[model samples]
Target chain A: MTEELLRLDGVSMQYGTGETRVTALSGIDLTVSRGELVAVMGASGSGKSTLLTVAGGLTTPTSGEVIVEGNWLSQLSPRQLATLRRRSLGFVFQDFNLIPSLTVLENVTLPLELDGFPGKRAKRPGLDALASVELLDKADRYPVDLSGGQQQRVAIARAVVGGRSLILADEPTGALDSTTGEVVLRMLRSRVDAGAGGILVTHDARHAAWADRIVFIRDGRLVDEAQTPPVTTLFEGADR
Target chain B: MSIRQSFLAILDQGACYGYQLRAEFDRRTGSTWPLNIGQIYSTLDRLERDGLVERTEADDSDHVYYAITPTGHDEVAQWLVSPVVRSTAAPRDELAMKLAIAITLPGVDITALIQAQRQATLRNLQELTRAKRAGGDGGAGDDLSWQLVIDSLIFQAEAEVRWLDHSETRLVRAKASGLAEPMPIDETRARRGRPARGGVPIDGKARA
Candidate 1:
């Protein structure tokens, strides 16, 4: 059995109170096992981004537990939580969020350095991550020097760099063309196949189709989950 | 879709035996459409009947070759430039009709149904993606027609998932806004027509 990487139990997030109150998430229970990619899909204002933030520990849920690698997030010290996030969690956003001034290699290794690994010691793993995305040769180049697709590949390299086992991606393909977006998704799939767990939040079903399972959110609650196995029933149903 | 047109187009290039024609079809189309030997013969027979092609005398190996007629060449030329026309009538899609019917029935769980279909469509999309990835540009010899077919299938599946999502969203909004109540058959209709005319003239029972 695959080890569980992350779990959200009865997770709910709220903003404000009374007249200004907004519930961004409600009693969401989810898990991302190692070697899995779970897609979260929903309409606008359905709280997909909120779920990723809560899962990544970027924001604490108003209720319930957020657990990463069997450790309860609420029980950790603030410094410990910061360390855990820096060491274990990675995030990719719609806009390729690389520091414009940093070279690709530096961006990838920054997480490791922040987690207390020496800058020099982080180079090998950072290079390995760049190579994984076929971007090793571009390590010395700045984000502006790369195409939108290449920059996103750099972002992905950063997300999966070192021992970071769980990735949270929110509309990662939203900025690229269809062909480029597919290439990036293929890279993500290869990473998950290489044994990392991920939660991909997307509004487009085409991108979500790359995931091992899909959970649909509605009004801040998970309304459905689908585990797909490259369906043959679609072609079989037609007598042609 | 038009095997006759394809056969003529291929024969326009040169004479070909029935088997050669099938192989040639597979070569160009990347075998997306499989043709049985009998189907090949049947199509050849029709083409021969229409004088679009003529059968040559059988050789010692009993292989019969077909050469395109001048009329066939003319037909091929026309077909090459002509755009295929789609029927204007609304298609009879069972899924859309079923969902339409389901939504009007109070007990049906439309959301569950939509989600199920969305999942199925997405699975097909993934499978198509897997197939495209595995095929890898269909090798170096030629441009892969199979990739185009796969792209079409992917787009269709994506459209299906998008429609399911759209339908579910519309349904949820309609339900919340009190527009989802079940409908009963109207009683004020003429005795003979479909859709039941709501204000047909009657013997004083119903009127406009």
Candidate 2:
């Protein structure tokens, strides 16, 4: 059996109280195990982003329990929670949020450095992540010097650096062209296949088709879940 | 497309012998639908009989060719401008019929049936994707048509995948909500020489 990296049991998040109150999530139960990528698809204002935020332990849920690697998040002190996030989680965003002044290698190594690993010790993993995305040659180049697609690739490199166990991506391909978007998704898929868990928040079905399973959200509730058929079944009867 | 109309459309470009027309048709469609030389000759013969084409002068190789007449040109223009109308009569779609029957039949695994069809559709989608990727520089002559044909196939396969997803969801919902369980057959009605209500005869004719 694969290791379970993340679990949310009946998680619900609400903002404000009384007339202005908003429920961002309602009784959400989700699990992400090693080597699996689950895609969350929904319309705008449907709580997909909130679900990610709560799962990452960036926001405390109003009710219900969130367990990460068998530890209840509510029991962890703020400092311990911060340490857990730094050591176990990675995030990729739609905007390719790399500091314009930082070189690709510096940006990727920043996470490891922030976690108190020596700069010299962080360099090898940073370089490995960049090479995995075929962007090592651009390691010395600044973010502003790269194309939008290349910048996104660098962001991906930063996410998987240091063997982060859980990846949370929100519209990771939203800013790229169709072909470039496919490249980003392919990279994400490869990483998840290599044993990391992932949750991809996207609205595009074609992109979600690459995930192990797709979860549909509506009105802040999971309305459906579809397991993508095996690749063998999907390509059955194909003329090879 | 009607063979009569296809012949006229091809002849509108220039005069061609039956075999040449057959080859052109195959090339333009990416051989998605191959035409037999015999079928092309028969279609040409009918077009000539209807005065839409006439024999042209034999070339140096002594090969007979036919050119489109004014009527044929007008017909081709009309056909091009007209939108294709879908017939109201149900098409003989094997997949649709199989699913419809499976839902009402006993012990048929509807999920498995739908899954098999979805797999086949996805396979077709992959093949079309490969074809599109291999067809580079679609701006070249003849490449444009092939590209468009592949695009049509891709769109169709994507739609099929979407529909299969929808059908599976609906099926699961129906089962969970107790809406799709087969109703018990009335023995009296079965014993009578009468067809069940809501069930159409295979020939589409009313029973006496």
| Best prediction by TM-score | 1
Please give, as one word, the docking class of candidate 2: incorrect
What's the C-alpha lDDT at position A1 in model 2? 88
Residue-level lDDT of model 1, residues A1-240, one tens digit each, is: 889999999999999999999999999999999999999999999999999999999899999999999989999998999988988888999999999988999999999988888989999999999999999999999999999999998888898899788989999999999989988998888898898999999999888888889898999999888786834533443322
> In model 2, where do residues sit more than 4 Å from their true spots?
A231-240, B1-208
- lDDT value for candidate 1? 0.88
TM for chain B in all models? 0.86, 0.83
The clash count of every prediction, one per candidate, is 0, 0
Tell the DockQ for candidate 2. 0.07
Question: What is the C-alpha RMSD, rounded to one decimal, of candidate 2?
Answer: 8.9
On residues B101-173, what C-alpha lDDT tens digit does candidate 1 reach at each position? Answer: 8988878888888888887787777777767766674455554777777777888889988889889889989
**lDDT accuracy of residue B39 in candidate 1:** 89
At residue A115, what lDDT does model 2 achieve? Answer: 96
Per-candidate DockQ vs. reference:
0.37, 0.07
